[model samples]
Target chain A: MIYKSLLPIIITLLITMAMLNYLISHVGNEEVKALEVENEYLLTINVFKQLNNTVPKIFQAKACLLISNPINYTCNVIASNITGIIMNALGIISNESSGVVRYEVVDYVIYGINNETIYYVTIKALTPMGDTTGIVGYTYPFNLCYYSQFIKELMNTLNANFTIDVENITVVQSSLGNEIINRVKSLIGTSSINITINIYYVGVFRMINRSINRTTYLGQVSYTARISPNNVHTCNEITTLAGAFYVTAVVNRYVNNTYYFSINGAININSMVINDKTR
Target chain B: MVVVDSLVFPDLVITMILIIIILLLIVYVTNQLIELSMIDYKASMGTYLFLKCQLGNFTIHLNHVIITNGTSSSNYLLICPQLVVNGSQIGAKVYTAYVKW
Candidate 1:
């Protein structure tokens, strides 16, 4: 009688264990799904990090080239090179089946090229969601702007160390020229590959537009200085009547945190002639 | 009548109580064993998954250790990590682990 009574309890225990096992496996399946989603996100994030790290290095190299040898590289050539490197990095990083990357140069600015050797450019890149084209099925939408931030920082650092006292202008053109030349000497003092300065008494005007606005300053000062890094020998000469404008503007529209700047200006170099000895 | 009342009925009641207690004990032990087995299963699966995936800065171990760089955590359960070996997909089982980056 005791054995007969125990049979039902044993059968129930077996059933309960079986059910619990099934429940545990079901839970595992759900957990696995969550894990897969997390992994996918991580994968994409890694690719983006790789791309971000690469961009600045390329820009820095290009900037160094531009600063060192200003005459050889125009802003156009530098911009094209930057664009190519960005696209190449994107291709290398996200070469997966459902990955695509594309970028465009929305705006750029070039200034003081023929006169003082300054170039500013910015490019905006877009990685849209879904495959707009069959070639690269878009994984996600990522908007990245590669600005001239690296170059800008370099210039800002250079400027801060040396201040130009523009508030006091001498009445005599010759005396005023002497004061300006001394200002350049104080700023350039024994450091830099080469130094060139063009001081302008140009009128300044601001033009506001929907996308980008630029300030145009038109004036002319004929000035050139040849300084030695040794600080042993320094000479600068100044002349007058050069028509040039310093154009500072935001020439590009910003989209999705990406900014485009178009930099355009014109100066008549013939009107302001620096003595070839100052070269 | 006195024997029935004092001895026989009392014996039957005691025996019934003993049987119920024994059944409860058995169920409790079975449940505990199941839980232990489940924990072991989870650990092994977690190890397998972690090793196979080769994710950055993630590891799985049964114990704890101090790390300097990134982040790490202990996982109790994991799907088997998938890997390609000899150009074929393979799944593996590993140990329960604490992962650190």
Candidate 2:
């Protein structure tokens, strides 16, 4: 009689415990979901803020480059001018070279004050690399004008005065391998209006690997740009003004058991710039 | 006397069966709960570490001591010091230091 009386109470206790466990788990799952959503929202907001802050500065610096005259501009002078402009525009200088030809321009139909100004400007410059024994190349592309307008609008919104446009950019290599030339060309091709680049001094060094039977090795590359551009004023006004920049690259070749790494640190200069602008 | 003995044996057997079943259920549920809780704790810890790692200097110091084990281990440590400009790491260097354990 006692057992029968206790059966209902025991059953009720078991059900209650099960329901409590379920409730706790549901609450925990909800909390986890909430935390995940919060993290994602924060990350997105941060990225948007960064983009908002950087685009204007870049636009201002590039605009300065486009409007500046390139005649009688030596590589060093251009680099210095680029540095100054970049500094003034609150931008960082990455790399500069003084031994190449650089030309850039943009053509756009501007509608302002009930008048459309179709204007084009091309700034071409050339510099020598390392005692006249370096490779030379030129980059001239006409499609950069569209991007110039985009930069102008961006600058206007930010109340900044710098802008950049890519009119026609072309890079050629006389001493470096076709591979290296192609890589540099591809990098330039990927840019819109503002020019930001890191020029590395690369040399080829090889090591042997045991997997490929006889001997295999990977190449070593090193890059340094300390003396290039340290300040904004020097970076935008001078380095970029140089139009074309030069850097050293090395190549490695291996045959049989002999490891051959060539010191191809010859000077190579490539130029880029905006050719024209309409304000 | 026979009826009393029979009743006592059956009661003891039923009690033992019930106890064993209840113990097994409790063990299973407790194990699951503990495993879930540990997972949640690790997730929270990872998130905290990630945020802490963004503090630049703090992250570098922590990684130097913990991840690289530079304090008690004999290994070469490379420190790249750079100023963050426009959300970019610039003026970086690779310096090597030897730690003696």
Every model's DockQ, to 2 decimals? 0.03, 0.03
For every candidate, give the share of true A-B contacts it also has.
0.00, 0.00
lDDT of 1 by residue, A39-85 (tens): 33333333333334444445445544444333345445665665555
Residue-level lDDT tens digits of model 2 in A42-155: 222222233234433433344335433222322233333433332322221111111121222111121112111122112222112111111111112222233334333322
What's the distance in Å from true for residue A274, model 1? Answer: 18
lDDT, model 1, position B10: 58
TM-score of 1: 0.32
For candidate 1, give the lDDT of residue A258.
20
**Which runs of model 2 end up more than 4 angstroms from their true locations?**
A1-16, A53-64, A67-279, B1-8, B46-50, B53-101
Give the TM-score of chain B in candidate 2: 0.50
How many residue pairs clash per model?
Answer: 14, 63
Give lDDT tens digits, candidate 1, residues B1-101: 89768766655675687567658857765775666565555545554554444543344444432222211223323222111111111111221223322
Error of 2 at A159 (Å): 31
